[model samples]
Target: MSDIPLIHFLIVAAALFSIGLAIVVTKKNLIGILLGIELMLNAVNINLVAFSRHDPERLGGQLFALFVIVVAAAEITVALAIILRVYGQYGTVEPDKIDGLKH
Candidate 1:
């Protein structure tokens, strides 16, 4: 069986992270930002899994990646709830237009 190189994994992770960052920066909608954040988290997970592949006994990197996934899931749930509430009150999801919270 042929094994893939570590560099390939690193390159893919970098690309995914860059795309996620770009989405976060360019998007104005709350959901779009959330999607970008998720993408970035997945990129991190990929890196973790890739590294963990080298040392199968420790499984540290894979464990950390699992933790990250759980946290990200919780974060998205809370974030979506907040976004819904904001949309309910303001009738829009654009962050810039929702200035009621500004103090």
Candidate 2:
């Protein structure tokens, strides 16, 4: 099998990050923003695992990527709960429309 170039992975990661950033910036829904954030984190994970491949012994980057995956999972759980609660209260997930809950 042919070896993949690091630049290829880097380019993909950069594209993912840019698309994610755009989603985060332009999307009105909180869930969409969360998805964008996930995309960005996945891009970073790709970079980490790709780099780790070069260091056959250490695998530190890959381990860190796993840690990140766990953290992201937990974050999604919490964020989704918050989003659902907000939706229940306000009938919407649009960030601009939320403006905090009243006392």
Q: Which pairs clash inside model 1?
A: none
Displacement of residue 103 (Cα, Å) in model 2 is 4.1
Worst 10 residues of 2 by lDDT: 94-103
Name model 1 segments beyond 4 Å from true. Answer: none
lDDT of 2 by residue, 1-103 (tens): 6789989999999999999999999999999999999999999999999899878899899999999999999999999999999999999999999887683
- For model 2, what is the C-alpha lDDT against the true structure? 0.94
Task: Give one digit per residue, the lDDT tens place, for model 1 in 63-84.
Answer: 9999999999999999999999
Give lDDT per model, in order.
Answer: 0.96, 0.94
Candidate 1, residue 5: the lDDT equals: 97
Best by lDDT: 1
lDDT of 2 at 30: 96
* Model 2 Cα shift for residue 70 (angstroms): 0.4
